[model samples]
Target: MSGTSEGPTPATDLSRPSVTQSDTTMCPSTEPAATAVARQAVAAAPPAPPRSGPGGPLPAAALTPMAQSAPTPVGFTGLAQRPPAAVPEPPLPEPPFRSAFSAAPLAMAVVDRDGLVVSANDTFGTLFGGGPEEFAGQPAADLVDLTSDARTRHAYHEVLRGGRARLRCARRLKHPDGHGLWVQITVAPLAPESPDVLLSVADISARRELQSRLRHLRNHDPVTRLPNRTLFFERLSAALEAESYERGGSGRIGLCYLDLDGFKAVNDTLGHRTGDRLLAAVAERLTRCADEAGHGRTSAPLVARLGGDEFALLVEDSTGTEQLAELAESVLTALQAPFEISGRRLSVSASIGVVERHAAGTSATALMQAADTTLYWAKADGKARWTLFDPERNARRMTRQALVSSLRAAVERGEFALEYQPLVGMDDGRLRGVEALVRWRHPQFGTLTPNRFIALAEEDGSIVPLGRWILATACRQARRWQLDHPDEPPIFVSVNVAVRQVWDSDLVADVAEVLAETGLAPHLLQLELTESAVMGSAGRPLQALRALSDMGVHIAIDDFGTGYSNLAYLSRLPVSALKLDGSFVRGFQHEERGGTAGRPSPADEVIVEAMVQLAHRLGLTVTAECVETCDQASRLRRIGCDTGQGWLYSRPVSPDRISELLGDRC
Candidate 1:
């Protein structure tokens, strides 16, 4: 029966006897021996009484009553009901995983799955004026008053959603100190765990200040502190775009490109610092003019420093050409006033080229090119003025530039040659000398006279080299002529010397070298200088002329009486002869008529003869120039003129023709 039945064991058997401390007793029972044994052990042990002392340990039964009472299973509601001790935990053994947020050098914080500040580093705590404990449970967004732009917020959301690896935003953080600080916040999401985000913030005030300074340097000229070319072009492009959108309905744009005349001389004479100060002053004046010009207009012109000694203005919505012209005139007038720079009052003038165009297909490059070309025209027309663009004039100007470019190689390529016009002795009909004249044999254009290119050469300063070549060529030809016709009277060769050549180089040395190379007598070579050129001579010119005069090289004043005539100074000069201007010689015809036909008008032959006699008395020989007719030549001869040069004898002819004439005359 015991083997087959499943029934409870007897109470007596279960109540087993007590054993010694070392011995263990076991109870036998039908209701699982383990349960019966547990009950017996609990009944046999005595429960501790409650402690009365303040520091005494709790009684075992009270301390673990639940553990002993029903033997509650582990890991269930009963075990969980017991409160944990209040002792501090060991900081949860710092987490093994490193937070991306904590790795940031700047202030950084981590927002956990609930958008709460789960963790913050020391830097983040200090940045917010709080500790990690204070910030831990707070909403992350609430810690930062993130009232940022919508775009910035969207970027932040993108980082939070793990759509972007990182997001940067410039935000204003409300600091504990009443003032808000600008910070650049970068947010990045943690890997594997999408719910967490890392935020890094940096103060950007100093960086922003640096960026502002860089922007200023980019837009403003370093020297004048005015808008530079970059800014000017930016403004111009904006104006053009605005005008284009307007479609010429009412608005117009005008550009004025001005270059200061004689500014190079100022830079060369004064120091560069002084030149810089002058440029600054010029910019100021231009700014003022632009302001005054745009008083009632839609927009004032924007003035800018384009480059060295150059400035520009952009006039917007001008009424008409008259308005633009008036503005340019005003600029000119404003610059006429003397500028006081570095304690020196210096005067300057500008040549302005202005172009006014409606909102059309005109481009900035085209407009600026037109203005630049027109400015050159203004300068060419004697500077300190303004010129408006004309298509025809611009076309001609292009041709002229092409010509100037071609002219540089003209001398070397044998395209240039000289011709001689005979100067006849007035007393006798014999040829005394010849004036060397330059001619250009252009490939396309026919032969050009000296008047056509001499000025160009002078302007380009090619006259220095061209004039030297002319002197050497003329001397060589003269020497050849003398050798061929030894019986003919010695004839002088007069070479026109340019003022620039006189001032820019050793004129006396050049003349001496040419004479020596050609084996021509010093007296046989005459240098003709314009009266104005002579009068404007400084110390170098005077010294040059004196040196030549000492070497027996004759100096003749060409185009006399046409310049600022100073007879007293002329007497003091080391000049040997005067070439009467064509105007006075042509007047001789009128003089002869006046004497024979009327009661001798003031311009009579008698007055002319008297002037000639006076010139002779002063030991000055007079040569009549441009005596076109034989009658004028005869009159000049009778008036005691030494020589006469005109088309009546011969136009300027080439060396071969001159040689033929020498043969015929001899």
Candidate 2:
């Protein structure tokens, strides 16, 4: 009530908005008859009772505390504070979920908040037997045997109390029927006022069995029925890891990696089926050998087949190198016995590489690498034997490998230089031409002769670039020599060429480029090759030599008579000269009368004479190599040899020395 005088009712007061009987009676004459009826009904009905909390009924004063304690204030009008809004009713549970769950096809159970089973479905009861009611009061984790592990049991309990939203795990269990079963269990929290969990179980036995079979097939070799490379590496890695974290053990590992020698020939001759049978037999023998080696040890060595014609026996916690050596010897002896395959008797031999060392610092990769290197050593040493690893020998091989890796770089960096050996006229004892010999000036090993790295270069195709460099460098030097001694005959320079250079690169193009660049005549350059390199080769080498000879480049057969001296083919080739091998000249160095040097045996003289006569008849000059004395030169002169190259003139010398020789002869 407002503090107005005498409390007269105000018709425009907004504080009292309800329609009274007087106001309704004085309503406009045009008002609708329905509105009048609603007003009368509202005025007739009483107001709603005050809302209350769950504990008890609440009064109007209790809802607005200021209204309960304060006196009325004039012109200060407002609504009292409102009570809080009522909470909404929860959604209705869909359908008859219990009936559907009870008869559901899936095996399921309900777990209470305490982790005990509240109920189970018909399918679950049938799966593990003993009806649905019997599952009650049992721990839910016990249904899938999760209680065996405390961690999983604790996680299950956490899921039941709603701490975790869901959980899934699998286990292998023995059923009441005495059969093993793999079960996948899933726990999901249910939505209810009283919190609970829904547990599901699935039989995964078939899937588990399939996975096991797949693992077996993947880890074993089909041909030999032994562990394959993948499994071997796996086991080796595990062993290394275990040894790295050793606990009072030997911390040692050993391996015997073997390869069947000439196994490819067997496969080619008898067919792969026979090869497979032979391999299987060999695996059995190796297994037996490994078992024998394992006597009085913790376990037998693991026998595995890595790939084609390769097998390994891995020993963990090896006693010493003697154990690995014994195992290798046993393998060699076992594989010696002949095997009958495809109605053919096959005798095979294995080369075994034995390596034993402390495993604490080694890895699978390093061990396998060492074993592979040692296996190569065994094969190179000779088949049908086992060789233990030696660090010094390995270091030498490692050095060779380093040299191979650095060869191309060395060539590019100009680490090679040429030395010229004078080839003299045998009759007049004058310099005819100089042979260009190449040497490697290694930074580490000082100067190295061609014999050290030439073969390696040839094997890896590095010889092509090296040969190109040699040709260019020698042609340039020869041109310079001609410039230095304008009065001399402009002596020719002979350079040795490896056979691989012809096929592996554009030799004719390289030589033409070099001659064009250096402004040197093609006739001033001679290319020498071993007899084996030129005698029997036809295709590319033939074409290259013919093309070069047509270009005025001389092709001489070097180290003659040491190889297939098919003298008949000599006339067909583009050869210009033949250099007799040093072996023949060394015969002249042999003593006869104990005190005085004598002529070579008649056999040597006749061979030289015959070779010289044949060459002269074929229109090719003959050069005698390794002549150290005037008697040898006179003998070669009598044999009709056109030129002689040996220490008699001088050892291989620098370009300056060649210039000095040319200066004197001029």
Candidate 3:
């Protein structure tokens, strides 16, 4: 071999050390040109025997019969170098196919078309708890539990047949030690022309467990383990969009909104810990009820806690209202049994609102709102019951709410106006006074009577502000009329007061301010409270009425005899007059077959006479309400009623029209 061909660059190859250059004994540093030439010449010659003495070839006896096949290196042998020889290049061998497969980190195996393992890496053996030799000829399906999954089997066959370039799947595998393992498995054709398939596996058990835990926490309540509100609404929204087979149509859904009656009291009396336990117990019972209701059905009912003591169930394919009603009833029945929590058996009842409808146009929010409103009805109608949604009632309630919102702004915007109905003197046939009927000039609904929104105002406590507005407006208008018509007797303006106004507002203060501001006499500004409200008054409300009465404000008990008539209270109250309810006044005439007027009903005549006599005895005036005809007016006059206010004098007319009536009568 020539010196350059057989040089240490290839034969020794020690210039680039595998370790640090400090460890030069195993691999030496590079040499100068002269030393390199000498080392190259020495390496090109045949191998010498192991040296016994310094620098020379081994003694002849030491070389005995052993020929070296390959050259060896000597450090500083100090022998004279021979001439450089020419060297021939050795033939190159083919690359081994199994080198990369044996060295890969992830478990890898080569399998035949039959899924029998031909060769596998040490990593595959270690991962599966076996050696490559032990896995050889063994069906790879046995190790991967292929019988448990058909898709995996198909994928395995496809890759082995070169039908697919590669395939991947996640599955649980059976280990040799009898435990199951989760792994991501990949299969691919071993080569373009090979009959064997290559398989790769990665351990992913931890990742899968983490994902499962995250999902569980997301969907379930931490305390009760029931689905939370997020999942509940998700499921409900899905149900609302789901198709139904019944009635040969689609879009049907039902929901039962549940609230535990007096649950707050329990939480207040018991600590939150006990309350938590109670909630858990309720959850279990509610879940049971849902499962029972959904038995044998493809779409089962989903029960979930919607925070606090409220829960709801989604009936995916509800048959009808009757089915929903039964489910609600079942919930109430289930809760009837006392729950044993913290060694105490506590009895509780739930109110449920049931709503079932075709889901075509109904949204989840609308459905939930309807259910919540109906739940209030169930509670209001006396608890421990379930209420089915009534569209008519809901519309009425929504209208009332809309009115409430508008009424608040109405006061601010001064959208209200007053109309007056004349109260005629029964004996004198003169206009004595007029009731100030509040009207709403609604931007949308036109003129609305007090009957439409008065009760709504009272319920929402908006009546306080609205009532003050009414009083001030009525007084100002009455003062204006009195100023305009100096020739006429000063007519009073009677303003109705609600029960809530009596309790919630400073009625005496409001009335006194209005009188002071309008310069109207208190006696001419009559405050009419329903009999039920006056009779029920006590404490602050009673004191308020008494204070107003002392200020010379005429206080009339309107709608008398319809409420609980406390005869004793009638004398004690600071009442000026009794306005008989229209129901009593309507009975006065029995229409005869002929057009001719008939006599008053004797029963009504006696009742009216008795009421008038009692009022006179109490030193209070009596006004007969609803006198619609001449016969009715004549009878009211004969009964000694001081005044009669009805359609006979006028239906409620605007202040301008009342001015026209006063011009004629006063």
* Highest-lDDT candidate: 2
lDDT of each: 0.71, 0.77, 0.75
Put down candidate 1 lDDT per residue, 486-583, tens digits, no spaces. 98877889999988998877888898899999999999999999999887666888889989999999899999878887777776688888888888
User: Which regions in candidate 3 have their CA more than 4 angstroms from the true location?
Assistant: 1-121, 125-181, 184-201, 222-224, 242-250, 262-288, 337-346, 459-461, 499-513, 516-519, 536-551, 567-573, 589-604, 663-666
Candidate 3, 1-666: lDDT as tens digits: 112321221111112211111111111122223322232222323433333322333332121111223333323433222333355233222122234445556677767788877556678898889775567767887776554456656656766676755555556666678876677665655434446666667776676677667867998898889999999888777666535333454457899999999888888998888889989999888888888988887656788988999999888767899889888888888898998888989888999999998887889999999999999999999989999999999998987778988878888898988888999898888888999888899998788998999988888888899889888988999999999999999999999988788787778888888899899998898989988888878898889888988999999999999898888998889999999999878876764345457654567778889989999999999998998888788878887999998888899988888788884642
Q: How well does candidate 2 score on lDDT at residue 571?
A: 83
Q: What's the TM for model 1?
A: 0.56
TM-score of each: 0.56, 0.69, 0.69
Which should have the higher lDDT, number 1 or number 3? 3
**Clash pairs for candidate 3:** 1-85, 1-86, 1-87, 2-85, 2-86, 2-87
In model 2, the worst 10-residue window by lDDT is 16-25
lDDT sort, best first:
2, 3, 1
lDDT of candidate 2 over 1-666, digit per residue (tens): 111221322222212221111111122232223222222221121222343333344332221222223322211122122233355233222223334565666677767677776566677888787777677767877677767666767677767666665555666666778877776666654432225566777676677677767878999999888999999999999888864437666889999999999999999988898889999999999989988887887789999999999999999888899989888888888988889888888999999999999988888998988999999988998878888988899888887998899999999999999999999887776677899888999998789888899999999999999999888889999999899888878889999999999888888999999999999999999999999999987888899999999999999999998999999889899999999998888786666544465545667778888999999999999999998888888888888999988887899999888887874431
